[model samples]
Target: MTERLRRALDARPRLTRWLLAGPGAVAAALLFAMAMPIWLPKGAAGIDNIVFPLILVPLIWAVVFVYACVEESLLRCVAVICGTAAVCGLTAAMAFTGWI
Candidate 1:
């Protein structure tokens, strides 16, 4: 039973592998982007208000492209973190400028 279960587990699609090493990261990024607005607080006072649309979106896309070509999961993680940062930074700048 354990052997069968292990095999089954192995057969299952791994999100980490897909996210970390496969082209699935691109798909994940797209899904994350599409779902971001829904999961994020659109009316929030910080990152949500600023980064979601511009810098973060482009950053995610760039990461997806770059990470898709490489096997490094760290780059993908960087993409996620940096994407958020880019968004937050842009948001802060925009808010400070009263563009929001």
Candidate 2:
């Protein structure tokens, strides 16, 4: 079972790399941005939380994408991206549920 899983994971390196660098990074970045408002200060004008995330989205995406592209271990790369997305997603969910 483990061997089959390993073979599947190793089957198409290029596709996996592209998937991680593209949609995976985008999803993580967007989730992080969405969760940012929960933690970011509202600033004097009370718009920083909104503005900052919008401004930082591209930078966030680029950084995640680059890391996914350059990381040596694919497992580690997936873990990092998925972990980030999961954390941010949970944060957003908690906020919506008024748990935070």
TM-score of each: 0.34, 0.84
Could you give candidate 1's per-residue lDDT for residues 1-100 as a string of tens digits? 6565445534643554454434444544555465464446766466673457544766776776565445344444545644654665565556557676
Worst 10 residues of 2 by lDDT: 1-10
Candidate 2 Cα RMSD (Å) = 2.3
Those runs of model 2 whose alpha carbons end farther than 4 Å from true positions after fitting are 1-8
| Candidate 1 global CA lDDT score | 0.53
Candidate 2, residues 1-100, lDDT tens digits: the string is 6566546657877888889998999999999999999999999999999999999999999999999989987767777898999999999999989999
Computed on alpha carbons, the lDDT of every model, listed in order, comes to 0.53, 0.90
Best by lDDT: 2
- In terms of lDDT, the poorest run of 10 residues in model 1 is 12-21
